[model samples]
Target: MALLTPEDLEDLLNKLRQSNETIKASTGKGITEICEEVYGTRPASQKVAIVPITAGNGIIGNFSSSLLAITEYFGLEGYITDHPDITGYHQAVSDGADILLMADDHMFIAHNLKNGKIAANHICTGVIYSEIASRFIHAGSKDVMVIGLGRVGYAGAEHLVKKGFNVYAYDPNTEFMEKAIEELGVNAYDSADHKKFSMVFEATPNANTISEGMITDRCLISTPGIPCALPAELAENGDIDLVMEPLVIGAAAMLYSVF
Candidate 1:
């Protein structure tokens, strides 16, 4: 996963609105709707606290505030901790926050105090994106390809396999690809085969992983990888419907999953 800078998420509310509209265009569902469907939970009438952790690289600019905005956007009552680190956690608990959202350099997570449910950003992100891809390919299409087998990509491939899609995965790491094949019952993705897919999930931190030849006439890409893997030329085509966002949808997923 790429470390997000404040610049990467500038004017985030408008960005989220655009992403929601794009999703509606492709699948007749918005971000909130898709998350509700995937997690079987709604954000309504929930109280959340954004606790910023100053571990490792310390606090990121606009990170905690962005999380607070996302919570409120989804109809959850949200608050930010006055302090950072462990003191902030206790403050959240003392103030009757049902859900606690926090992140360090290594992990971003949401925890439901009452339910004891923990949601990791990487896993929920993959699952939600995979679910979106599944909705766009209902024409007996099962050849779903997942590009990148890191933490997020692996979680997505597993979810796709569970949903009865014949998952084909590609990662630069041979060990990661082999582990996915052995554990999740997935096949290796062959880019050279010129296999065109109706649904593709891309989660690489790198850019331009999908070239022009990799797409069919009508293809749907659900990507959460920063600096999206699709180039501008391929994305401009009318036949391609893309669903990509930097952080809002993933953070929303983390909250809803444990609510």
Candidate 2:
């Protein structure tokens, strides 16, 4: 993932403004109803809060990931507490937090090859597909490659395949590869090949997985940084036309992007 320049940051802020406006203008159902539709029931209701615990250094690209800051905007209750021996999930449970918006390390970083081709934001649990698919559509890329096959990779890749993006996937996990192809209709490939593509969506957070020069010139890429995926490298490279940050945007939006 690349770093964000002042200009790029401005553009991102503009896109986010637009996105938020669109979100406010368009509405088909209530939040609880939407949650029920996705979770098969209303998310347990509780006063949500953020527990203090530093996510290890693996989550560098990600900054300011606490959902507590936005709880009021979302009509939720919450508090932030630094507590030892408390996982965010369990802490939320302990505090009677029915809805736990845990900070996700998985960040979505995209390098756009074309101007105005991609957008970046943090993806949350709300709407995962909205952010990802919107980036693809915005970039106008037809062929997409997805890296890694963990929970995020699988879901994001499957969503893209279902949306007809000529999705090709590479994962070290053969088991995951087989399941993704067999069950999700994605074209799975070996990770060692490093194929050229119009666009690559990387889900691995390890810095080694996606480094400078990993992609040929003019190829756009998205980095799903581990823990907190940030497009740090992609943003620094002049060749990167645009970058998308998915974790902050919402996981549900990412889920909605493909499927």
Candidate 3:
């Protein structure tokens, strides 16, 4: 499948609103309604600060634009900062910012902050695996392969298993793989065995973890990991359908947790 355009995302959100009665009831509103409430009608005056932490320079490039777009769509005030360290987080808090949002490397930062190691009211807006699993189920995928057994990948595999999918998982870390097998009862497989699955979810941060050779004909790949796991050639040639859901969805979920 081709990457989801903004219009496609709107359509998907609409479909989700109509079909997911539980979400509608729990949220008590649709995406737009919640956006207005959480972000406020005048977001410019609200002033939410965003910090992007990663090794690369262009880490905030597109993500900054996406956050700006979200603010614009909901009429909220938000901006991305060039600084991505603990100092920057303190500055944002001292400046009376409503939310100090961190992207990427947030898990590490949040962990440290929660243990009285950092002085910032910050949360990571990067937990998307559960939503990714829901997306796979919505797309009619029943058998799934999960690559990487980190926190996000393990959570995604657990959701799929609970939904009664035939889940196979892999990870370079033996401990993570063993825990998934013993606790979740997921089928353990070598990374090379990915071809056996029609639907694959990759959560590894490494680039090109799933190479051209590993992709079977007509496989569907859903990856949320930065530096994307699959090769460009396979995704470009249409041998496999690749879906990288917008990071804004994860950010929205994180925001929902706050309210």
Candidate 4:
């Protein structure tokens, strides 16, 4: 059976909003830190990992997995790393991995950057993230509020701010909020500041974040287009939409047509 429907999507979104309290009660480490601790223990110049990863965690893991597949398609070898395992470190290093392909979780890539050990590549969930951010900024959304602050959230916020969004992020973890303000110069508000921007990009993996009531009616909510932690309801509703598959095929076809 389909995991999500329109009503289910709304319910899931509500649940996500509620989960914020729990997230707030926990340790506030940014996604970059989480990723660093996960796969940055080993240091090599030309290593890779390929293991079980999917879009289940939303765009971060899904995109990372996709990136791993793409790199491998180009003839690169990677260590197969999985979350919820303490031994991924040993396995990756043993496989001679210089660059570990893991989930695009927070602080995982950022930590690698700070350590100056390895380069982290992010798999984008949708081209729309950059597109929406760009559009909103061009329309003068200076005090932009980015929700989620997870892998995709952080990436979107960073890109948006770089383009002069004056990004303000909303996440349950204090760690994420701090990173937004300190590292990215985003305001990091805790609540929904709907009136501030004419456009809003929903980067949360959970499809439930943009139910009828959660999102402002006036703000433009660009769907992930790419698969992520999408609620089954949203997936089934067909309203949220999917873009990655079509975009990929379209790009390939266009290239072939041009060639």
Candidate 5:
């Protein structure tokens, strides 16, 4: 996953609201509703604790607070700890938090104490975004295209294949592409292929990979990549409906997965 900067998260609550509306307009469901449908999760009646860890690069500005806001938006009770690291974890357990959320530079995770279930951000992100993309393109679409078969990308590719879509996948790394092909029964997509699909899942960290020529006017793109593959102008122009929010979707997915 691409590391997020503090600037990328400014006014994140408002951005998430707009993103939820964007998703609802396309799929006829909000983020929480989609998460529930994808994960078989319902309204969480558990107390959630967002703990800020001062390890690695230390706390990201507003990460814990943003999680608290997201939890509340999902109609769950949540709060940030008064301290950081282990102390915060102890406080969460002592304060009777049923779910614990924490992150280091390497991974973000959600843990449900009652069920001993854990959800990692990367896997949940892929599954959630792929489901959103699948739902976005309603009918007359049988093939799905996936770019960047990395950790996150591979998970989405696997899910799409299991859903009975002819998943065409590509990555610069031949090993990753081969693994997805052999393991998940996905079709290999090469750069020479000019054909486009009704749904495209962009998970590459690089930008400008999904050019305008590759997408039709009715395409629906679901991307979790930090530097999105599509241009900003096209995402807003009223042509294709694009779903590209950064961390919020993944965080919500993790929460619901463990919920």
Candidate 6:
């Protein structure tokens, strides 16, 4: 995907804010009240402690700021801490945060916390596959290739399957490929066969994961991966439609789930 212009980002934020407002109006409650009704007794307070952990090198601050904007738009307090270690999570919990939030490479922190390695109630906000699936649905594509079977890619494939799309998944890791095939019932394909797809979901975190020759002419590439899976020259000049955005789309999804 292409980088969203400032105007596009602003418009998206406004739309999300409006959606939240509509939910509040229909439910006759605020975020905390809605959370209590749906998710049992979460902390009623509206504060999130953000612990940044390797949220992409230069774009960390930008990602954090976008998350803060989402929180503030929902009338929640966002406390962002600088430290990206165990200490930061502890500090966030100590700072009266209702939920500890992490993004990007720090996503593993949530799994660690769940496994009892970290003593904190946390949420990792980046399940962007649903967003990609929504885009694909809008584009009227029912068959697509998922180019990675990592956490995010697998989640995306699952979402596509739920939406009644034909999902063909690929990964160099056989174990991941097997899980996708067995659990999600996705078709397994070799990476060398990527060119066969007219619609592709590229979710590997490596640059140039989707090479020029691997992309079909007029393919629709939906990529939420970091460092970009498609090359810049191909995305700019080739016969393909590339969709991309900041990682905040996943953050918004997480926030909605929390509330």
**Highest lDDT model number:** 1
Model 5 agreement with the true structure over 100-150: per-residue lDDT tens digits: 999998889999988899998889989888887777735367788898898
Off by over 4 Å in 3: 1-47, 51-70, 73-75, 79-98, 103-130, 133-141, 190-195, 211-216, 245-249
lDDT of 4 by residue, 14-64 (tens): 333332222222213221222233233322233355433233443332343
Indicate the worst ten consecutive residues by lDDT in candidate 3. 117-126
**Which has the greatest TM-score?**
1
- TM-scores for every candidate against the unseen true structure: 0.96, 0.50, 0.57, 0.41, 0.94, 0.60
Query: TM-score order of candidates, best first?
Result: 1, 5, 6, 3, 2, 4
Candidate 1 lDDT over residue span 120-192, tens digit each: 9999999988888877843347778899999999999999999999888889899998899999989897878
lDDT of all predictions: 0.87, 0.46, 0.55, 0.42, 0.84, 0.57
Indicate the TM-score of model 1: 0.96
lDDT of 3 at 6: 41
How many clashes does the backbone of model 3 have? 3
Say which prediction, candidate 5 or candidate 6, comes out ahead on TM-score: 5
Tens-place lDDT digits, model 3, residues 1-259: 1222344344433334343343333223444444445334323344556666664332544554565555444455777775766766777777766655664433422112222222111222222343343343224456678887876688778767876877888898999989999999998876555446656778866778776555456666766676667777666764455555445444554443443
Cα lDDT of model 3 overall? 0.55
lDDT of 6 by residue, 15-110 (tens): 545434433433344334444443343323457777766534323435455667766765677877867656777887677666566644334222
Model 4 TM = 0.41
**In model 5, what is the error at residue 243, expressed in angstroms?**
0.8
When sorted by lDDT, best at the front, the candidate numbers are: 1, 5, 6, 3, 2, 4
Candidate 2 differs from the real structure by a C-alpha RMSD in angstroms, to one decimal, of 11.0
lDDT for model 2 comes to 0.46
Q: What residue runs in model 4 are displaced by over 4 Å at the alpha carbon?
A: 1-128, 136-140, 190-196, 211-216, 223-259
